[model samples]
Target: MDTVADRVKHLRKQLKLTQTTLGQCAGGISKQAVSQWERGITEPQWEALNALQRACGVNPYWLLHGTAPMLESEHTPSADATPVGPSPPGHPGTCPLAELLDDLSRRLAAADPAVRDEVTRLVLRYLENPPAGARIAKAIELLLGEDENLPPA
Candidate 1:
C-alpha cells in the first residue's frame, strides 16, 4: 500500500534533499514535520503541499494519489500562458543563475554523503539568513571549495 508518506520520501530522495532542507523549501516547515509525514504519522496540509509543489515542482495530484506523473507535462501549458521575458540589461552569459545552480548540483551529486551533509548544512544556514555584500561572495566561494589536500585537476 503505497502512501503519501512513501511518495514524499521517494521524492525527497530523488531530489537529493535532506528532510530538513525539504522542509525549508516548503515554506519554512520543520524537520520534525517532514519526519512525521515520511513516517506516516501525519500528512501535509493543503498550504504546505502547495509550498512543496512550488519548491520542488512536484505534481500535487501525484503527491496525493501516486497516480499521475510526478511532474507536470511540458505540453500541457495553455496557449495563453505567459511568455518568458527578456534577461536583465546587464545580465551576462544567458541564465547565469541557472548555470551556477546546475554546476553546484552536479558537484553536490558527486560529493560523498558526509561531505554532502556538511555542505547542505552550510547552504541551509546561508539561505535562512543570507549575508550582505562581500560576505555573500565569500560564502559562495567557501561553499564551492574543494578539500585542500586534493590534487589539482
Candidate 2:
C-alpha cells in the first residue's frame, strides 16, 4: 500500500467494487489489468485514468500527483447551508437549462458506470459549443428513443 496501486485499490474498495467490477467501471479494462495495477506490476493507461475520473468522480490530479482530495468537490451546498446573497440569474434550480443538465447528471449517475462514462464524454463534447435549445431537445429525443423501438415522433 505504498504507491498508486494502493490508491487504486483503496478507491475501488471505497466504491465497494471487486477487481472485475472495477475494471468494468474503468472503461472496460480487463480484470488482469486491474490485478496488475493492484500488484504494482503495471500502471494504468491514460484512458483508464480518465475512465476512473468519470466513473468514480475521482480527482485526476489526486490520482496522478496525490496532491488533493481523491474526489473532486463541486462545492455542492450542504443541506444545512443557508443562502446569503441573491442567487445567480442562471443558477441550477432557477434556469431551465441548468435544471436539465442537473437532471441529466443525476440520471446518468445511476447508469452502468461504463455507460455513464461514455455519456459524460458525450455531454462534455456537447457543452463545448452548445446548440440551440430546440437542437438539444431533438438530440435528447434521438438519444432516448422509445423502449418499444418506435421511431422518433
Against the hidden reference, what TM-scores do the models get? 0.48, 0.47
Give lDDT for model 2: 0.59
Q: 1-153 in candidate 1: lDDT tens per residue?
A: 289899989989988999999898777889999999999999775446557766677765567777556765423545563222222235532332233344455676767787667665654443333333235435544665763433454
Which TM-score value belongs to model 1? 0.48
Query: Which lDDT value does model 2 have at 130?
Result: 38
Task: Provide the overall lDDT of each model, using Cα atoms, as 2-decimal numbers.
Answer: 0.62, 0.59
Error of 2 at 21 (Å): 1.1
- Per-residue CA lDDT of candidate 2, range 97-148, in tens? 2334444555555566766666555554443333443454445434543323
Estimate the overall C-alpha local distance difference test score of candidate 1: 0.62
Which numbered prediction scores highest in lDDT against the true structure?
1
Residue 133 of model 2: what lDDT?
Answer: 35
